[model samples]
Target: MQDAGFVWNAEELDAFIESPRKHVRGTNMSYPGERRPEKRAAIIEYLTQLSTAD
Candidate 1:
């Protein structure tokens, strides 16, 4: 989900990152483990890096 240096609106980015589980219900994805926090943090960090990269 990292934008890889692409620009996106702050609201859109926040929605994607803080979206509720129900919003993702139809997707074929699952985070069923204790590593969920770590994984999510990694994604956020990656996206942040991409957003901040010049």
Candidate 2:
């Protein structure tokens, strides 16, 4: 939960993966989130591993 209002947690990640524009309006990004649910899961898993690494 880095952001005050929005926490980058699993639930939020699911929503974001579903649709980047819907998740955050007027978003500025070169490429939007993955269209495939499985791919999104992989990316999230990788991120979690990195985040938890000490």
Candidate 3:
């Protein structure tokens, strides 16, 4: 999370997954975010698991 410069929560992760560029203007990351809700939810779930497993 050091790279993000902030603590990520559920809503923040959802928004970020929807659009990285829109979330953080002028970010170098060019990766277009997930268009499918299921996929995005999965990714967020996985990330959450990582955070909690620590």
Which prediction has the highest lDDT against the true structure?
Answer: 3
Provide the lowest-lDDT 10-residue window in model 2.
1-10
Off by over 4 Å in 3: 1-7
lDDT of each: 0.50, 0.75, 0.81
Per-model TM-score versus the true fold = 0.41, 0.73, 0.77
Please give the distance, in angstroms, between residue 37's alpha carbon in candidate 1 and its true position after superposition: 0.6
Q: Write the per-residue lDDT of candidate 1 for residues 1-54, one digit (tens) a residue.
A: 342334555434443455533334444436432235555566677888998999
Sort the predicted structures by lDDT, highest score first.
Answer: 3, 2, 1
Using TM-score as the measure, the top candidate is: 3
Quick one: ranking by TM-score, best first?
3, 2, 1
- Give the CA lDDT, 0 to 100, for residue 14 in model 3: 85
**Could you tell me how far off, in angstroms, the CA of residue 7 lies in candidate 3 after the best superposition?**
4.7
Question: At residue 33, what lDDT does model 3 achieve?
Answer: 90
**Model 2 quality (TM-score):** 0.73
**Candidate 2: misplaced stretches above 4 Å?**
1-4
Show pairs that collide, candidate 1. none
> How well is each residue in 1-54 modelled by candidate 2, as lDDT tens digits?
233259789878877877777787767644567788888888889989999999
> Looking at model 3, which ten-residue stretch has the lowest summed lDDT?
1-10
